[model samples]
Every structure is written in C-alpha cells, then in structure tokens.
Target chain A: MLKLDNIKTYYGNIQALKGISLEVKKGEIICLIGANGAGKSTTLMSISGIEPPRSGSIFLEGIDITGMPAHQIVTMGLSQVPEGRRIFPQLSVLENLDMGAYLRRDKEEQKRDLEYVFDLFPILSQRRNQSGGTLSGGEQQMLAISRALMAKPRILLMDEPSLGLAPIIVQQIFGIITRINKEQGTTIFLVEQNANQALKIADRGYVLQNGMIVKSDTSSALMADEEVKNAYLGV
Target chain B: MKYFLQLVLAGLTKGSIYALIALGYTMVYGIIKLINFAHGEIYMIGAFTALIVGGALQITTGLSPLTILAISLAAAIFFSSGYGVTMEKIAYKPLRNAPRLTALISAIGMSLILQNYVLLAQTSDFLPFRSMIPNFPFLTPGKSLVTTTQLVILITTVVVMVILTLLIKFTRTGKAMRATSQDKVMAQLVGIDINKVITFTFAVGSATAAIGGVLIANHTGQINFYIGFLAGIKAFVAAVLGGIGSIPGAVLGSLVLGMTESFGAGYISSAYEDVFAFIILILILIFKPSGLLGRNEIEKV
Candidate 1:
C-alpha cells in the first residue's frame, strides 16, 4: 500500500497541492477524478518524486520514501506513464521497452517481462523496430503502458491514459487496465478526466477540486452521488 | 590522378580528426542541448596529457614505442574524460534548471577558464608532438604518397566510429542514454539515473576528443593552448553542418568540410581554405537548416 500524509506541493510561490492526503491499498484500482488544474498530476508527481512535496511524507508499504530522487523511487517498485506518452521518438520500440527495465539486473526475468509486454500489446511486437514517434496515438499510449509494465512495478501511476484517444481505444485501454489489476495484481493509481470510464473501472475513487480532496468513496457510490454525477460524469 | 588521390587521402586524415571532435559536440548537444564550448579545451588537455605522459615515459623508462603510445593514449583519455566530467559537474549541473542562455554563457566562461588554466600550467607556445608509430613505406610509389601515420589515423578513426556506433545501438546504457535524451523525466521514471547517463556521455565524448587531439597533434607535429579554439570551432561547424545532434551527420559534415578545405587549397589558394569550409557550412544551412542528416521533428500538440 502507498500512503500520503498531508502532502503540500508548490510550484514556486504558487501552491499546487494544499495538504492533500490519499491512500492506495495493495492490488486495487484507485482513480483520482478532477478537472484541469485540480492538482491530480501534481499529486502523482509529488509521490513519484519528480516534484517532491514541500511538507509531509509519502510511504510505500511501511518505508518512508519522502523526497527521494525520482530514479530511486522507481527502483522502490513505482513507475509512471506520464501524461503524454513520452516515449523516446528516436529509439526503436524494442529499445524503448528495454529502457523500461533499465534498473533490473535479472536477465531471465527481464526477458519474460518483455515477452509478456509484447503479448499484451501485439502492435508493439509488430513495430518493434520502428521509432516510437512514428506510432499512432493509441499505439504510443499502449507502448507507454507496456514500457511501464516492463519495470515490473508494484504500483503503476498512470496520468490520463485515455487523454486524446478515441472512445473505442479508451474502452480497450480501460479494459487492459482492469485486466492488469485483476490478473497481475498490480496496484494502480489512475488520474483521469474521463470520470465515467475511470469510475467504472476503479474499485474506489476520490474527487480533487482546486488542490484539495473533496470526496472519497466506493466507485459505485461516487457514480450514484448526485453532485458527483452533475459535476464530473455528466450523467 | 595521383594528385587527386593525395588530396583525398590528406582530406580523409584531417576529416577523421574533425569527426572525432564533432562527436563530442553532437553527443553533448543531443543530451543537454548545450554546445559545450569547453569541449575544445578538453581536447587541448588531452594533447597535453599525452605529451606529458609520453615524454615522462621516454625519459624514465625504456619502453617500446608501441607500449609508450598505448600508455600515453590511455592516460590522455582518462585525464581528459575526468576533466570533462568535472566541467559538467561544476559548470553545468547547477544551471540545469536555469535558462538555456545561462548554460551557454556558463559554457563560454568554462572555456575561458580552461584555456587560461592550460596557458598558465603549460607554456602558451607550440609544443612538438613526437610520432608514436614506427616508420613504414608509402602505399604508392608515386608523388602522391600515403604515409604510415595517415594510414594509422584513418584506420583508427574508422575503428573508433564502428565501436561507437555499436555502443550506441546495442548496449543497455546506450538505450538509457537515448531514453534520457528523449525525455529526462520519463527516463527517471523508468529508473535511469539521468546524471549517470549524462556523465557517461561527457566521458565518452571527451575520450573521443582526446584521441582526436593526440592524433591531430601527432599529424601536424605541433600543438598550442590556442589550437583547440580554431579546431573546436571547425568541429562545431562540422557538427552543425551534419545536424547538431546526429552522430552520422557529424561524421558526414566533417568529411565534407575536410574535402572542401583540401580541394580548395589544392586548386585555388591555401589562404582561403577556412573560408571554403565556412562557405560550405553556410550553403548547407541555407538549404537545409536542420543539417544534412538531421530530421526536422514535428512538434506533437
């Protein structure tokens, strides 16, 4: 499990997250639904150590990982598929995936993970030698997720995987996310603007508004809540 | 025909050195988008290190020429790479989050500091670089001749290029480097130590520049503190001409620049050789702003 204790993050003098706290239990799909500038990405970034919180601590299992360097956080079994599928445009698909497992020394396990990734996204295998930039948006997103999976992470932090994708593609990606959580037993902390799709797949959900968490409940309850429906789901 | 062959051979010899130095520029530019003006100083230091190590070995020990050459080359590479890494840590790392112009100004400052340090440490006058290779007969029996040293430079450059290409293509560290160059944050999220990769790039680039300094000094038989300035400028021009961040582009640009200078001097006038090189660069830039091998990447919204 991962826990954040009253974390406060800032961008220079401007506060981004004001005493935000959240929890992601093991093997659960937890989604954070918020509008633009709601500090969803900021929360994930603070946890991932890209932008460390100015105040309070983050814990993975029982270990304090507050203010650790980003690379070290990844080694501690956390990985992120950033908002934009920031794949190396010049590198071949295989090389990009290879970079995902950069810290792992176990060759056999790496090979197995690579095979699993290829199987999960067959398009990646087909275009294994092509440059990542040349891929379609959906394909690039798939490659990004597959690349993150190559790390064999205990927790995968995905920021807007459904952003800028077609509805069908979004459905497919969400299905994959669901399968990943149920079958692989990997904990996921998903941040999404698509509340309808996200809440459907998530076991639990939290609503963030203006750098603060306003609601947290079971996904079904959040879906049924009149305010949640009006504000987010547009139901 | 023989004269043409001689010009081509000489051009290749000079081109190989430019290519070596240009690789350093391109690699650093690719990773951090810094021009690294101090890179030339690293080359000068490399030549100095080789000179000191080779001279000391000759005076203190009775070693074979080949052994001395190996030892001196290794020392130069090691020392120059260390200087490269140090320069990055002290001058560039602090300014990583600052504006790009700040880094550029810092690079120019670093260059001045390195040049002055070398001038104070070693004499500003040109120092002779003794040939390490044993004498060998010319490949051709005509006026247009190929010496053993020219052959050595060409062969060494080719071998190094091949090895570098392989390193960037097949290695895990290379993949990490490519990843870092593409997106530093994503690379970190994937558990790559960005600082380590950047340092490795600087070290490898400096090592190549070191070898270039050693070979070029040996070829010309003289080196000075200010030699790196002109050579570095020419190599920078080559890197830009080839597409600043592309590896093969750097080599291509160097060869083209070298051939232009050689042919210009041979057919026209030696005094206008540098002009010829710059003319080619300007022409290339005018026509293809991205350089010969560089792709104009479209920004995805």
Candidate 2:
C-alpha cells in the first residue's frame, strides 16, 4: 500500500503539485489520469523521491518515506518505470536488464526474474546481445517495463506507458499490465494521459487537474460520469 | 632507419605516459561531465609521494632498487587515490546539481589549492629521482632502441589498458559504472548508490594517474611541484583530442599527439613542438569536433 497526504511540490518558485492526497491498497492497479501539465508525472515523481514534495509526507505500507533519496526509495521495494523508456543507449539489452536487478544479490532469484521478463517479451531475448538503442520503439517499451519488473519490487510505478504507442501495442501493453498484476500480485500505480485505456483496466481512478485531485471514484462510475467522458474520454 | 626507430620508440614511450594520465581525465569527465581540472594536480601529488617514499626508503633501509620502487609505487597509489576521493568529496560532490560553470570553477579552485599545498609542503625546486628499474642486458642504455624505463612504460601501459578494458567490459561494478555514466536517473531507479560509484571511479582513475606520475618521474629522473601543470595540460589535450568521454579515444589521442610532437620536433623545428600539437588540435576540432571516436556532440569543458 502507498499513500500521499496533501503533498506540495515546487520547481523553484512555481508550484507544480499544489496539494495532492491519494492512496492505493495492496495488489490493486490504481491509475491517475489527467491532461498534459496537470501534474500526473509530478505526482509519480514525488512518490519516487526524484522530485520530493516540499510539504506533507508519503508512506509505503505505512512507512514514512518523505524526503528519501531515489535510490533509497528503490531499496525500500519501490520501483519506477519512468516516461520515455530511458534505457541506457550504449548498453546491451542484457546489460540494461542486469542494471534493473542491481540491488539483488541472490543469483537464483535474479535468474528467475530474468527468465520471467524474457518470457513476457520474447523479442527482447532475441535481441539480448544487441545494444538497447538499436531496438524498435515497441521493443524498447517492452524492455523498459521488463526492466522495472526485473527489480522484483513489491510496488511498481509507471508513467505514460501508452504514450506514442500504436493502438494495438497499447492494447497489448495494457493486457500485460493486467496480466502482471493478476499473476505476480504486484501493486501498480500507473499514471496516464490515455484516460480510456487506463480506466478500462484500473480498479479505481483519480482525476488530477492543475496539481489538484478533482475527482476520485471507482472505474465504472468514472466511465459513466458526463464531465469525465467529455473532458478526458473524448467520446 | 636507426634514428627513425629511436624516434618512434621515444614517441611511443611519451605517448604511453600521456595515455595513462588522459584516462583519468576521460573517466572523470564521462561520469560527472566535469573536466576535473584537479586531475593534473593529483598526478603531481602522486609523483611527490613516490619521491618522498622512494627517497625515505633509500636513507632508512638497505632495500633493493626494485623493492624501493615497488614500495614507492604503492605509496603513490594510496596517496593519490585518497587525494582524488577527498577532492571530489570536498569540492565537487556538494556541487552535484550546480551549474556546469560553477562546478568547473570549483575544479580550477581545487587544482590551485592542491598545487599551492604542494608548493608549501615540498620544495618548488626540481628534485632528483633515482631510476630504480633494474637494468637488463638487452635493454642496456646504448645497446637497444628502447631504454629500460621506456620498455617498462610501454609494457606497464599495455598491461593497465588490458586490465581496464576487461574490468569495464566484464566486471559487475564496471558495468554499474557504464550504466551510471549513461543514465543517472534510471541508474538510481535500479538501486545503485551513484555517489559510491562516483567515489570508486575517482579512486580507480586517480590510481592510474598515480602510476603514470611515478613512471614518468622514474623515466625523467627529475620532478618539481609544477611538473603536473604541463603534463596535465598535455594529457587534457589528449583526452579532448580522442574524445573526452571515450576511453580508447584518450589512448589514441595520446599516441597521435605523442607521435606528432616526436616527429615534428625530430624533423621540423624542435622549438615549435608545443605549437605543432595545438595546430593539430585546432584542425581536428574544426573538421570533426566530436573527436575521432566520440559519440557525444561537442560541449567544451
């Protein structure tokens, strides 16, 4: 479980996250949806400790993690699959995967996780020895997600996995997201601009507007809401 | 042909020394994007340490020449590595998020501080360094093209190069270093303590520079507090020439620069050797600023 309480974050004098409060129970896929610059990524970044909130506190399984460094947060079993799939360009695919499990010293567990990721994306295994920069966008995305999975974290935070992806690939990625949750029983906190796809898979969703949470409800209720449909669903 | 062979041998010997020093520059620059202007002073400190240790051993004990040199070399690595890590911690670590210009100014300041510290602690005059390498029959001073010192320099360089390549390509910490250099944010997401990686890089790079400092002191048989200045500048040029962020590029640049100086001074006017080195740099930067093997675009440090 993860929780945020009235967190405020700033970039110099300008406030990007005015005051955000939300929570996700264990083993559930929770998504935060908003338009561009509505603070979706900022929220995730705050939780990940890359952009720490200036005020309020964040908790992971009731452990306060405010003001923690990014690496420390990761060691606490929190992993982030950041936007743009920033795979180390010059490193081979296998090397990138190796970096994901950087903290894990147990050889057997790392190998098992490696095999699991390879099974999730067979193309990645095919391009195992090739440099990550040489991979296609779809393969890169898959690698990015698989890299996060390789961390074997108890909770995973993903930002805009469907961005710039084709509709079919988005569907495939979303299916895998659902599958990863069901099979691994890992808790996921996803941030997305694609409200339609995100709501389809999320159990509960929150709508962020200008760094404030405007609405929070179950996915079905949000899907039927008139304002939500017109503003974000684009129907 | 004899003269030519001698010149080639001399150039390679000089180039190998430059390569060792330039590696420190390239490795430091690769990780933090800081030019580490103090790197030259670290080399200077290394040489000073070897001189002190080597001289002290001569007076204090009846050690063999090889044994004294080995002890001096170890002391150089220890002191140089310590200074390097301390310099980063004191000067550069706090400025991790500061502007590039700020960090660079800090580096220059650190360099000046170390230079002055040595100038005050040790005499600024050139100190005589006894060449401790055991002379071999085949490597007799006038009998072979390569002197004993030159042969050791070349062989030591090759061995160091081979080990460094293997470490970066195969070792876990080395892989983590490459990963950290590539993406700091993602590296953290994977739970790598970046500060530790940075400290390790400084230690290794400084150790290599220390080896260079000691070797060059042995080869030249003389040293001063200011020796690091010219050597550091030349090595910096070598790093930039080969591509500041690339490893092999530093070695290539050092060799090319060494040959240019050697052949230029050998055949052309010897007085303008420094001028010739700069001319080559200007031409290469004009044509391909990314450097011979560089992948990143030009961002002068």
Candidate 3:
C-alpha cells in the first residue's frame, strides 16, 4: 500500500500538483484519469521520487519515503513504467529487462522473474535480441510494463501505457495489467487519459483536473455518477 | 617505398595515441552530453606524474622493456584517474544541474588551472624521459628499428581500447553506463546510481588519456605544461570526425587524422599539416555530420 499525504510538486515557478492526497491499497489497480496537464503524471512521479513533492509526505508500506532519490525508491520495491515508454533504445529487449531488475541481488530469482516477464509478453521473448528502438509502439509499451514487472516490485506505477497504441493493443495491455494484478499480487497505480478503459479495471479511481483531485470513488460509483459521466465519459 | 613505409609506421603510432585520447572525448560526451575540455589536462597530469615518479624517484628498473612499460602505464592510469574523479566531483557535478554552457566554461577554467598548476610546479621548460629507463628496440626491420616507445604507444592504445570496449559491452556496470547515457531518468528509475556511473565514465576516459599522455611523452621525447591544449583540440577533432560519441568512430577518426597529418607532412607540406586535419573535419561535418560509424539519432517531439 502507498499513501500520498498533501503532496505538492512544482516545475520551476509553476505548480503541477497542489496539495494532492491519495491512497493506493495492496494488490489493487487504482487509476488516476485526467485531461492534459491534470497532474496525473505528476502524482505518479511524486510517489516514484522522480519528482519529489515540494511539501508533505509519501509513505510506502507504512514507511515514509519522502524525498528519497528515484533509484533508492526503486530498490525499495517501487518501479515506474515512465511516460512515452522511455525504454533504452540502444539496448536489446533482454538488456532492457535486466536494467529493470538493476538492484536485485539474487541471480536465480532474476532469471525466474525474467522468465515470468517473457511469458507475460512473449513478443519480448521472441524479439529478445532486437533493439528496443526497433519495436513498434505497442510492443515498446509491453516491454515497458514487462520491464517494470522484472523488478518484482511491491507496486508498479505506469504513466499512460496506452497513450499512442492502437485500440486493440490498448485492450491487450489493459488485460495484461489486470492479469498482473491478479497473478502477481502487484499493486498498480495507473495514470491514464483513457477514462473508460481505466475505470473499467481500476477497483478505485480518481479524477484530476488542473492539479487538483476533483473526485475519488470506487470504480462503479465513479462510472455511475452523472457528473463523472458528463465531465469525463462525455455521456 | 621505404619512405612511405616509415610514414605509415609513424602514422600508426601517432594514430594510436590520438585514438586513445579521442576515446576520452567521445566517452565523456556520450554519457554527459557535454565536452569535458579539461580531459586533455588530465592526460597532461598523467605524463607529469610519470615524470615526477620516474624522474625524481628513479624508480625505473632495467629488467625487461615489458616491466617498465607496465609500471609506466599503471602510474599514468592511477594519476589521471585521481585527477579525473576529483575534477568531476568538484567542477562538473556542481554544474551538472546548470546549463551545458556552464559546465563547458567550468571545464575551460579547470583546464587553465591545471595548466597553471603544472607550469608552476615543473616550470615552462619541456622535459625529457628520465634517462634511467634506457630505450630498447621493440620494432626492428633490418636497418630501421622502431623504438620501444612507439611499440609501447601502439600496444597501450590497443590495450586501452580493448579493455574499454569489453567494459562497455559486456559488464553489468557497462550496461548501467549505457542505460544512464540513453536516459538518465529511466536509468535512475531502474535503480542505477547515476553519479557512480558518471564517475566511472570519467575514470575510464581519464585512464585512457593517461596512457595517451605517457605514450606522447615517450614518442615525442618532450612535454610542455600547455601541451594539453593542442592535444585536446586535436582529440576533440578526432572525436567529431569519428562521429561525436561513437567509440570505434573515435579510433577510426584518430587513424584518419594521424595518417592525414603524417602523409601530408611527408609528401605535401609540413606547415599545412594542422590545416589539413581541420579541413577534413570541416568536410566531414559538411558532408556527414555524424562521423563514419555514427548512427543518426532521431528525436521524437
């Protein structure tokens, strides 16, 4: 489980997340849906320590990890499949996965996790030797998620994994996310612009607008709410 | 034909040194995205350290040429790595968050400081290799035998390149280094210690330049305090000529530049040798901005 208590983050003079607070429970898929510049990514970044919250605290598994370096946070079982699927382009698909488990000490466990990842994304296994840059956008997204899974982290944070993929691939990726949650018991905090698909699988969901969390509810409640439907679902 | 053979010999020796030095430039630029102008000064410091240890201490033993060569290489690697790690920690790391220009200016400042520091210590006079280590012939061809120095230069350069290539290609640390270079954010996200990788990059580069400095000293038989500037510019040219951040490109560029200069001086005009090197650089930039072995990088918006 993770908790962000009154987190504030900024880029130079502009505030990106203004005292936003949220909680994600263990083995749950919690999606934050928002329009452009709605602080969804910022929230994820704050938790992952890529963008340290200017104020307040973040707790992972009841331990305060506020302001720790990104790499340290990763070693503490928090991993992010960053925006734009920023996989190492020059590296082979296998090498990219190895990078995800950079902090692991157990070589046998690493091999086992690698096998699990390859099973989750068989395309990555088939193209293990292919350069990451050569992969299609959907494959790259798969590699990105599979890479995060390689860490065997307690929680996985994904930023817009479906941003530019085709609808079918998006569905496939979403399905994998559900399976990963169910099988590995990996808590997922997904930030997405596709409100409908995100809410479908997300047990709990939050709506963000202009650096503020406008709504937070169980996925069904958020779906049935008229305001959430009109504002985000375009009903 | 004999003259051509000699030119090739000299070119190969000089080319190898240039390749070693240029590797420093290319490696640093590859990871940090900024030119560490003071890298040449690190080389100079290495040569000076060798001079002090070999000259002042008389540490040279007349065993085999191989032993002396190994000791010299070790000394150079040690001194240059020290200076490089210190320089990165003090000068580069502070400006890492600043703009690229700030780091560049700091590098220039460090270069000047290093030059002045050597000038003050060793004085402006060019120094020779300490006489304790008598020259032994390593390359002999009937009447013309290449000095142990030239052989050492070629051998060391190749050795450094091989070690670096292996380090970058196959090692876990090397993989971390490549990842860090590709994307620092993602690298950090994956638990790579970016600072440590950057420091290791600096160490590797400086170590290569150290070997280059010792070889240059032994081959040319003299080194002034300000030698780093000319060598730095030439190595930078080689780096750019080979395709800015490519390792093999640096080696290839160095060979081309060295051969161009050697043959140019031998057949064309000695005074115009530097001009020829720059001309080739300009031509390469104009025709193919990415050197011979460099791949074009595509940026997505």
Span of ten consecutive residues with least summed lDDT in model 2 chain B = B292-301
Worst 10 residues of 1 chain A by lDDT: A114-123
DockQ winner among the candidates?
A: 1
Expressed as tens digits, the lDDT of each residue in A1-235 for candidate 3 is 8998999999998999988889999989999998998988888888888889899899999999999988889888999998999989999999999998888889999999888988888989999999999999999999999888888898999999989889999999999999999999999999988889999999999999999888999999999999989888888
Docking class of 2: medium
Query: Relative to the true structure, how large is the alpha-carbon lDDT of every model?
Result: 0.91, 0.91, 0.87
True contacts kept of each: 0.94, 0.82, 0.86
What is the CA-based DockQ of model 1?
A: 0.87
lDDT score of residue A68 within candidate 1: 93
Q: Once superposed on the true structure, which residue ranges of model 1 sit more than 4 Å away at CA?
A: B137-144
Model 2 C-alpha lDDT versus the unseen true structure: 0.91
Each model's DockQ?
Answer: 0.87, 0.63, 0.81
Q: For all candidates listed, what's the TM-score of chain B alone? A: 0.96, 0.97, 0.93
Clashing residue pairs in candidate 1 are: none
After superposition, which runs of candidate 3 have C-alpha atoms over 4 Å from their true positions? Answer: B59-69, B131-142
Clash number for model 2?
Answer: 0
